[model samples]
Target: MRRAAQGMLATIALALLTAPSSLARVYLTQDQALALAFPAPASVQRRTLYLDAAQAARAGREAGGAVETRVVPYYVGTAEGRPVGYAYFDTHLVRTLPETIMVLLAADGRIRRIDILSFDEPEDYKPTERWLQQFPGRGPGDELSLNGGIHALTGATLSARAVTQAARRVVALHRLFVAPFPPPSGPAPGKGDGAPPGAPGAVRP
Candidate 1:
């Protein structure tokens, strides 16, 4: 009888341990961001950031130096009429700024591909993971007010704000630069642009 009780308790504990946390949320990818908000054709290339130090330095100047940035690739795919998925750079924004920033190229205003150039944050970052999910359907057009969309946690407001700001910055950059240019034939992305080093078959497009 005691053994049976122990077994039941163990089973319950296991279930609790594996259960999905209620606070967990999900975010979109680089390709998705473009689909939701297409940049002008002229601004597409300006969205990308190469991994070389010189380029990083240039980006620093552009972003007001001292802020690291990672370049993420967004491919926008479309369906019949309305927008579908919205993609953004998949790298952690607040934690990995300056190290990686995302660039988006959209087709039919939907995201179809994603490339994450830098992910300085630990892969298992728990606090910020839930917050990233809040950005998928939002854009500058959303006219997001502070304290809108997702609520910030009591202890993690700073991280949440960083994410929101980062998303806003990305959207603003695309709108400012890429929204005006005509669509050019997107070239096959090469190494060091956003591809993870030594990862075979890891192209964004």
Candidate 2:
């Protein structure tokens, strides 16, 4: 019996060593998270807008005729060795509702970036794949030059709007709460006390 118990203990130790670290536990695998982030589009429409910086000034001025409408912009940079503009999405399983938020931060309280990560109901929320694709490679100075004219995907305008607005919210939050808060080394604090690394929010895996 003692031998059998020792074998069981050894097996448990082996499993723990092979598992992903605690930090990795909180984050879902990329594929699994993406599944929740982007949903099926209800419809699609063709529209074109010039994403160039020069064109933005022209659109902002003339701001007439057929122009781009779905213009979303974001910044990309780094802080304390971490990429600052990649969106962060967090949600709890309790409410069955999640929030996707994008945040940009500098070493201090300044927003130098943006991206809309979300906690949304897939059925009610439009997928963001198309809208997000628009901001790639855009520089910090580029304006969300929507005077160009926004393309609408037939029945998908609601989805399009959701995507655009989410981007706007992210930008706003960046400006509001832009600080370099790195992932916590310990768990989130409880009612009055702080949580340590292995508890609740502290438990990653």
TM-score of each: 0.36, 0.31
* Residue range 34-63, candidate 1, lDDT tens digits: 434454332222124223444344334433
Residue runs of model 2 more than 4 Å from their true location after superposition: 1-80, 90-131, 138-150, 179-205
After superposition, the stretches of candidate 1 with alpha carbons farther than 4 Å from their true spots are 1-130, 180-205
How well does candidate 2 score on lDDT at residue 160? Answer: 51
RMSD of each: 11.3, 19.5
lDDT score, candidate 1, position 39:
44
**Which candidate gets the maximum TM-score versus the true structure?**
1
**Residue 175 lDDT in candidate 1:** 38
Report residue 153 deviation for candidate 2 (angstroms): 2.7
lDDT of 2: 0.36
List the lowest-lDDT window of 10 residues for candidate 2.
Answer: 42-51
Clashes of each: 41, 19
